[model samples]
Target: MQIQGLHHAQITIPKGREQEGRQFYCELLGLEEMEKPEALKGRGGFWLHAGNLQVHVGTEDGDARSATKAHLAYEVTGLEAWKETLRAQGLVPEESVPVPGMERFEFRDPFGNRVELLEVTEDPSL
Candidate 1:
């Protein structure tokens, strides 16, 4: 059987730092917060409405996040504007490796999670 698409993705923040996570993911990033299920409400962290999918930020011991290359890359429009927006907040966007027909950059969230924003420069077909 063919697989379906992603339902959600999860990232972690240091335990007891949920407010910081919310500030970065919500206030700065512009993702809207979603209510957690009752059974999951007691757990730390929150969910975000990201396009059609959800991003679940869970709380845990997040000491090693910056040491890994694992990250989330979001497809967006107006790449240059995004870069400026990030810079305005004192966040530097690092140039990413070249990928045909795409312009992109990455930056670490306050909690060290690598977040990428990319825009299609040409038809995506290869």
Candidate 2:
């Protein structure tokens, strides 16, 4: 058996904090927000896309904890411009990430979820 690529990744934010999710994920990060399916519309969250990848931002209590170590890496274009934009918002990333195949840096969202923006220059699948 083989596992395919990811279907989606979920992150939690406090209830009534979806607006901040919108500000960071949509407005600041440039992810395109999409309508959640009808069956899940009332659950109090939203979906976003970067390329074909889905990130589900869900609502929960303020006690929702974020991992300080793990994060999601999204392949990006115009990475230098992103650095400037994030810096302007006081969301600076640590740019000295020394991954051999990826030029990447990581930052935290408003809800404290860690995320990495990477430009992969090599095919690891080879």
Per-prediction backbone clash count = 0, 0
User: Residues 34-60, candidate 2, lDDT per residue (tens digit)?
Assistant: 889999989998999878889888998
Per-residue lDDT of candidate 1, residues 10-55 (tens digit): 9999989999888888898889999999999888889999899999
Per-prediction TM-score, please? 0.93, 0.86
lDDT (Cα, 0-100) at 73 in candidate 1? 87
- Model 1, residue 13: what's the lDDT? 94
* Candidate 1 residue pairs that clash: none
Best by TM-score: 1
Clashing pairs in 2: none
Q: Could you tell me the TM-score of candidate 2?
A: 0.86
Please list the Cα RMSD from the true structure of every candidate, rounded to 1 decimal place.
Answer: 1.3, 2.0
Q: Which ten residues in a row have the lowest lDDT in candidate 2?
A: 62-71
Which regions in candidate 1 have their CA more than 4 angstroms from the true location? none
